[model samples]
Target: MTKRAKNTPRWTAGMACGLAIGIGLGIVLDNIVLGIALALCLGVALAYALPSKDTQA
Candidate 1:
């Protein structure tokens, strides 16, 4: 298995997901830009707030 980088934070996946959600929300809400921005911030925040899923042995 690939090892995670020591200094890198696992925010990419979270951010991507947030962005995707934001895009959809924006489309539905008629505010793509705001949706993306808000979602991105929330996503990054959640990424930091949540515990890592992978554990090192």
Candidate 2:
């Protein structure tokens, strides 16, 4: 049996959420540039705000 990684999942979730939101916003707003910019900014901000694996342990 193998133990699953922890922080990796959380990070993945964050990225997925960011991507979904960004894509949705971009589609609804009809602006590729704005969507990409917002997605990147939000993604980075969220990633920074979340606790890292080292910190959790």
Candidate 1, residue 14: lDDT:
71
- Listed per candidate, the RMSD to the true structure in angstroms reads 6.7, 7.6
Task: Name the lDDT of candidate 2.
Answer: 0.72
**Residue 34 of candidate 1: its Cα lDDT?**
85
Clashing pairs in 2: none
Q: Identify the runs in model 1 with alpha carbons over 4 angstroms from their true place.
A: 1-9, 53-57
For residues 1-57, could you state the per-residue lDDT of candidate 1 as single tens digits? 997655334697777777778777888999878898878887887666655656344
Top lDDT prediction, candidate number: 1
What lDDT does each candidate get?
A: 0.73, 0.72
Residue 1 error, candidate 2, Å:
45
Q: Score candidate 2 by TM-score against the native.
A: 0.62
Count of clashing pairs, candidate 2: 0
TM-score against truth, every candidate: 0.59, 0.62
